[model samples]
Target: MVLHVVIASVAALAGRSVPSMALPKKRERAAPVVSAASSAMQMQPAPINPDWIIAGEPVARMADHSKSADRAAYTALWDCTAGTFRWFFAWDETVHILEGEVHVTAEDGSVHMLRTGDVAYFKAGTWATWRVDTYVRKVAFLRRPFPAPIAFAYRLKNKLLPAKTPTL
Candidate 1:
């Protein structure tokens, strides 16, 4: 598609290369290990939706967990190879970079750099472009996402009905 070509061209000009739109072969793997920290050596390439690719082949590896069937809370370790791509957040995510670097450009054009030990928050509904300068590794915490109005209401309720403190 024309969009893909445009994205690839723009990325090249920015000194980043993007892979073609062809779907890379998916390799089979065993179930992920649910743990507090990843061993790193066992991480595998994450499955990516083709529609999300922009340029040069960006690949991600992840080990993730969900709190429950309702999808309230989630956590994951994600690693990505050097590449450029688009990310649309549907859940509030807080990421702590463990290795490498990334430059993220928000929809408003503001740019942020994330490097080792840096933490970044992406609210639900945010649109951004992520250009990975080097292979990167991160640990991410994801909270249940809500629409604007619902989110506001939830916050207000929490303030009104605070949890009771236990007396010693």
Candidate 2:
């Protein structure tokens, strides 16, 4: 239905009439399917020393940063193996696990087991412990917290002066 509408619209815009079939002269190219692991591998993540460690041995990390916008938004591919540690998030993070298994314990002691194809979110100021049983590879999207006064001002400005959309 959408294709038909698009064909009709294109014909109208070109000042041409559409045939009953309205078949295209050329075939569309097929896009290749890319696996998450394959794409992460393409990232060429670099090994780095763990910044913080709480218990057991320190885990090894390989990370590739895809983007960092004003230190506000960050996107990365991270891989870690064999360690357990506590974290206090200063930023909000959303992670999609691509490989391995992990057990995450919240501040209140609720445990969440995550494995391949699982996703989790950690809010700013939230405390959690992560136990990587074997290994874990994930894509993370993080948003750092803004200063309270700046955040309040930005919110007030947006509320008072909403954006205007121009008419065509």
Q: Which candidate should be chosen as best, given TM-score against the real structure? A: 1
* lDDT (10s digit) by residue, model 1, range 36-95: 546744576785566877887888988764354445778888989878888988888999
Which stretches in model 1 have alpha-carbon errors above 4 Å? 1-35, 65-70, 147-152, 158-168
State in Å the error of residue 55, model 2.
3.9
1-168 per-residue lDDT for model 2 (tens digits): 654455455545444332345657885553343234445454443533355555566455545454442347776777777788777777899989989988999988899998999999998989888888778888888898765544555565567666789899
The regions of model 2 sitting more than 4 angstroms off are: 1-54, 153-168
The deviation in Å at residue 74 for candidate 1 is: 0.3
Root-mean-square deviation of Cα positions for candidate 1 versus the true structure, in angstroms: 15.9
Q: How does candidate 1 fare on TM-score?
A: 0.66
lDDT of each: 0.76, 0.69
Model 2 lDDT-worst window of ten: 29-38
lDDT of 2 at 30: 36
